[model samples]
Target: MANNNVSAICSCCSEMDGIFSRLLILTSSITRRLIEFFEDILLRDVNRLLRDSEINSYGQSQTSATYASSSRDCNSDTSIAFLDRNASDLDDHHSLTNSGLEIVNRNYHRGVRFIFKGLMLPLYCFEFAWGSVIASWRCSCYHMRCMQANMQSFVSRIVKTLHGSSDDIGWLQSAPGMAPVEDGSARFVELLQGIRNGLHKLPDSFVYLLIPGLFSNLGPLYFVSTKRFFSKMGLACHIAKIHSEASVEQNAWELKQYIEELYWGSGKRVMLLGHSKGGVDAAAALSIYSEELRDKVAGLALVQSPYGGTPIASDILREGQVADKETRRIMEFLICKLIKGDIRALEDLTYEKRKEFVGAHKLPENIPIISFHSEASVAPGVIATLSHIAHAELPWLPQFPGEDRENDDFALAARKVPVVFPVSAAMALSALHLQLRYGEKSDGLVTCRDAEVPGSIVVKPERKLDHSWMVYSSWKKDPEDSSEVDACEMCEALLTMLVELGEERSN
Candidate 1:
């Protein structure tokens, strides 16, 4: 009985061993197959990239040959140089011939033969390492080519749109350029000086509406200072309470309704002043519902607005750009999932969407428009500048109904903490990118060219102001300047210019 039990135990152990061996074999097989699958994919991609490179090189070689032929015609020494170069290349190739193999075979001792055979292992290892590097290089080249092609195509389309072609007349040619943009910088500077002296005050004939830009919802203080400044002058000033993260069309509709409500309540035309994406939204409102809004809105001043399109948006969201899909996914997640905002809010700003939207809806020629754009300083000192984003209100301790709230020591607990960030650094980086890549001047967000609305009076400020500088106050104030010209004064100057333009149009 004991012997039989021991044998059963041994048989069970043997069964477990067999199962483990089978599992190991299965895992090895799967791993080998996976490696082979990846190897095949790598080879395919590398080959495709190589073929593309070859095609491009062939064209370049043909061009070079033609040039060389022409040069040879001019001087026979050129042909001799070319021939000598080709001969040297041939000599280099011949250097890698079977001379080594012949030497090994000549000294074919048993030990030498074994050593030669053993060298195959290290040779294969070297081949694998070198192949991996080549594969990576080729893959990088492939993606680079794709990115270049995408950029070229995008640029070509933009160029075509800028310069009218036979098939499609450029939009820029027929769009707002028909009216011609007036240089109002000199006049703007004078008005700004008058504003600083508190001379050119806005008339009470219109209700001023300040529309905030993207992420305005998060920063409750956005346009708050500007509104307060306007209010101090006893002017009917209000910030348009619309979701800044909403699509341009959606915001446009909201803005239209808001303008109508303001007009009906106050019995006055709304003077719309918008910053960044807000400007785009306001313009869309006027364009889409021109018949309705033309009578309600007095004028529009787009401050640092990308009315045409932003290259930053185009590059990130553009198809076929390097890591385009990945970048879009990241942006979508951040905008939609994290911020609870629509992706279309950002997508609408892209070149493709802007082109389509602008083509469909044109801004009314009657409304006085002012395009304001500034270049941000890319100096290292600017990076240290801080921007006031919002205030964090801390929770206070609850008191009884009859308790004196003013005397409570915990009243100070609910004190608002100023939230600040180094937004200038980000702006400087973006401005640097735009400057380096496109040789375009930008306010760290919108390029000067893109901000200029063709039909409007363009205000190109000499002062180096960033995108955030127009709306948010900077922590560091220049003490050297005796006259401190704030955002309020700048805004007043813009509106003053708009008023003049309106009178000019009327005359």
Candidate 2:
């Protein structure tokens, strides 16, 4: 589809079949890109021909008086301004097509063109029957592809979790131009020096409390090699012992109590360095801690944490994999009972739940909070965009039987772009679903926008890291897998910032 075209929601259906469940999205992506190839070629040439013919006719002498302007097809034609990839072209609001006939993609079944350039096929009595058949087939294909893709994805993740190896697989690869990063220390040496200078007046007794993320209970495993680097800076860093998969509210309350009596009541403030859910929990605890207790809590440095709940949590919790309906229930039972995790941990991370929590509790005043967020998906070819929500919501799409036409407006559709790598067919569905829900690209787990807080200072030169890569260096096979190392340095800087801010407030 052209850059000017907007996406619409699909009307594809699903049958109770297994093969279609997984391959449908992959198939859909292939089909949609093929359609784009054809459309891009045909549309561009047609417009060029029309534009040239008009120019030729305009140059003819006495063309206006002798050749009646009323007879010219210009009035019936819609002018198309061929768009380009420059940032300025995004502002083109022209909604007209060359011949004034709307073009629909065979796969996406959506888009708007200012100039009509296709065959003037006359509609007959078969229009209803044809549309009905197409809609039915679309729905069926969609469901099957989703099912197959998800099943394969779930199995792959399980295999990876148990065996700790799957890099040999042909489907997954480091995205083009995404090589493993060299050691992170080199990137932040200048920044670290500047921070050290600014915070040189800090007291020697302040402690750095490292709060690990969900399922991160093993001491400093999430922070990887960065803890040792901090110890060298004369900071006493300790990992908090809260249950990994517990509710944020519960963990926050518990963490609050632990912090209040920490350091044998010596009154040294605890600088919190939290990752993922740990970050969210720390923020919640800071909101509830009393002024005296809150005073002891120095600052917060949240890394790759979802301040807004991730849609993946809701999708997995509420709607299990199409191929495995019991995956959610079974995982909950096993993790909560065997691993001793709180069953409601997933629930606490829902968007609605977190919004309610933030609304109910206010953060402590004058506490310096620095946040770092990351959102990245493999930038695959046409296939990547197909799975994205933007492509799924084109306005020219056939409406589902259950669609609310009143809410389906062309203006609300997202612009389509072929970006993001669908790691698996299952991830394709996730990418597609997320994009449809939020109309934004995401790092398989969380949208970048959701990871940030309103008042926090974001690190410059934002890292293009993914959620899992923030902690585990082994998520990808590439050599540049040390974002967690960089993040640790960022946390150290924030810790220093907190001490500097505290001194300024005290004086």
Candidate 3:
């Protein structure tokens, strides 16, 4: 997997580009702040004489407070406001996730391939002498451990969701985390069969619109292959032809146009099933578009959608690489281009950006949203030996900052405004930026906390389900591959449920 070719694109080269861009933002921020600082000093000196003459004309302290309050308001509206991230909040050395991360970090060494670095001698020797067997062994060992500790739970929850007899699923809609997700595997299969029957027997009137994620139309390539798969099951599903790489607003507008232009039977409501960013974009469309369009939509099934945006978005914004180079190019070709030339798209996926969009728009009051989010990870893996550790030991990644709130007034005067906020190195970035709240449970993209959209029926976090696996390669052909989780069967079941829900709502 090492890109050692002399002319091939390098991750470090991308990293350097990211560093350069951040520096630009930092420079501009610094220049602006310095100008303001000098302006304040001059104004203070000039106002001293006036203050001395007037004696009680609006006390300086009071004026300062008024200005500060206004500045806070403006800052909240326009900028990303960060909660005080204490050092205590990080480095959860007591969990399996951390341990797994450490294992990966310790042995799976990254050799810099760029000739410009002029530092290939050591890694080359290691690769040539040992034939890279040591590195391979280290990676295999860690992956094995991840499987050993996590596979049973993963198979039970995710695997059982498909083939097992149990119906217990962690439901987020209510207080009870564990509830019946299905009657049984047999009943679910019957439901799947029923959906197929209905679709085969039904007329053109029955249409379920599938909206793909970021950088997609029809869905991701893997998702696209499943297109005729849903149709054969008896539902007339059409992929919403949306510009997958556009901002949510842009995508929404396009969707609004598509929905409005559609020819539907009298009183026929359309079913919308959006995956990943498509779900968020669909919500945005319904939120901002006309009520007429809202009336046409039956219900939305958001599958593994990031309604609150992923922390990875922040990582990409501060870093130059987007999903690595090859995957990035595939995304570009498949979805009208992704992050290489389009940084704004990445910016739009940041937590702050999503928050702004959600806050500004109102979710329609009547339409039902059936949202399912799945994340599989354990936090504090660094110290998994500590059995007493509670899942909540690490706070949830701050999605809208509800439970991890700091006092708004905490050391307000002493806080230094950051001219250039720092970003962590990308090597173990996920391990470091993980949310303690969800116990670092993520789909390799969105945290479960962030995925849970308020005022919707939600499936509580499902283990063994990573971001890519949810839509692409849920089950590995080889058991040796630690990353795979059997998600395809579970996903098909969810779609059947959505079709059933849509049928009920449409009628």
Candidate 4:
């Protein structure tokens, strides 16, 4: 009886050993297959990205070739100026064609890629947990190391392909052949002081065109107060009515026509002072239509303009960037479907687009250009400030069928309300991000480096002012606001400096 019991115990022990062996084998096989599958996926994705990069490279090469051919054609033509205009139009079309669908498709794929990664998150976690266990038992970290190496390589490749070659990715830095930036801070101060003392006034010989930036159409009060202030000072100031969300070239054409009309009507040269993207649009107008606008325009003041490029636009729109597709999709929906604006309106401000555009069309050296940029304070108090973005008038309610007769007048009156925004908080957050990530100083949207236009007088103000500070009124009063350096006085100073620069250049 004892021998039989011992035999049963031995048999049970053998059976358990076999079961454990099979389980080990199964787990090992599953782990190996998962590793292989993930690596294969990584390989395929990398290959696809490479192919896309090559395709984009080919497209850019073709564009350059076309531009060269057009230049040659223009040079050969007897009517060079007219042909130059035609060539510029062709270049605009090419730019639209190249960037439009390609950008959309890349963004869609990026969003899809994000969804895919989220869906596979569980699998990824499981694999990592299992991988660690396998590594412990086998005492070999080779498989995990290999997977990590591949992942790092994959990420590096994506960044490389997205930004192009290392040499081509210097959009944040000043471009080669760009004119050196000159400090106009001292002169600007003098001018500001002069304005405050009523010693300096903007010349009445020119029609001051105050061009507002992106989405300015929605904000009826944008630059309205400034215009009123200018009017009070007996200046012929007018706010441009162009669609702020239109493409740079499109707006430029409209601006050119506007400048011509202003010049023809008043027999006075138009002095343009554009804020944010409006500055970019105004500069584009002068650059593209230099021949026609040489005598018609006196000067340009690009206040907080991203003349070079803005990293906000570039990072959001650049392919292979993390969350690039998701951000682009959101922007496209907002700008395209919701606002009925061109996506190119945002794209044109990107580092890549700005580099290309600025390279192709140089700003005419004849025009006196002033570039003004300031840093936004990211202090905690700034987050609490509110800004007026828009104004809305509620429709008057008709007194119908004897309803609430006593309060009818109160109820029926049209309600005028200001649309306020926490723009200061938004600016603070973005400024913090830029500072943390790139260590670059920005006015919430445009970095100091980006706003400094080549060959233009650059003014770096010590005052901490956000991008909207110039155009939008703040709910919270600035404690440091001096009696002399208000927005209107600052405008007067900039134009006065510009007028002096023009005179000096003419002499």
For each candidate in the order shown, give its overall lDDT on alpha carbons: 0.77, 0.57, 0.53, 0.79
For model 1, residues 384-468, the per-residue Cα lDDT tens digits are 6644343444446565676655455554334545667567789998999777866778888888877888788889888888898
Worst 10 residues of 1 by lDDT: 162-171
> Model 2, residue 416: displacement in angstroms?
45
Which runs in model 2 stand beyond 4 Å of their true positions?
A: 1-203, 218-220, 263-266, 319-328, 377-437, 472-485, 503-507
Better of 3 and 4 by TM-score: 4
Candidate 2 lDDT for residue 129: 54
Please report how far candidate 3 places residue 234 from its true position, in Å: 3.6
TM-score order of candidates, top first:
4, 1, 2, 3
lDDT of 4 by residue, 1-507 (tens): 544554565566556656756766786678667755765676577557756865686577667656766667645554455557656866676577557547755675576567656766776676677656544633433454556567776787577545532233235344678787689999999888877767856878889999999988876678876787788678899999899999999999999999999999999999999999999999999999999999999999999998887878777787765666788899999999998999999999988888899989999999999999999999877776644343444546455676664455544333435677667789988899888867788999898888988888989887888898788543334566664256767888899998999999999
Error of 3 at 295 (Å): 2.0
Model 3, span 1-507: residue lDDT tens: 122431133345445556755665675577556655755575565456444634443355346545655667656533232212211222232244446545644333232123312443564454455535544645665575566556555545444323221111112224232222322334444544554344332334545677888655422343543455566566566778866777788888888877765535334556677888888888888899847676777667677787777666644343223234454455445444424334445567776677677767777856767667654443444224222210111123333534223343333212323221111122123433454423455555666656666766666532444454455432114567543333434455555565555566558
Candidate 4 displacement at residue 277 in angstroms: 0.4
Off by over 4 Å in 4: 1-154, 157-174, 386-419, 473-484
Per residue, candidate 2 scores C-alpha lDDT tens digits across 1-507 of 311121122322223223443455565567557666867887676668666755564455234433454455464332121112221332231233333324423222333221111221222223445556766867765676677677778877665343321221111113232122212233234455654445433345777777788777632345643564567557677777889788888898888877876745666778887888888889888887656556677778777677766766655554323433476778678678777898677777766566677667777657766666654544455234443210212347566676665454443233222233243344445555566655656655666556665556554334445554445322213345433234444566656666655677778
Of candidate 2, the 10-residue stretch with the lowest lDDT total is: 164-173
Candidate 4 lowest-lDDT run of ten: 164-173
| TM-score for candidate 3 | 0.44
Q: Is candidate 1 or 2 superior in lDDT?
A: 1
Question: Using lDDT as the measure, which candidate wins?
Answer: 4
RMSD of 2: 35.3
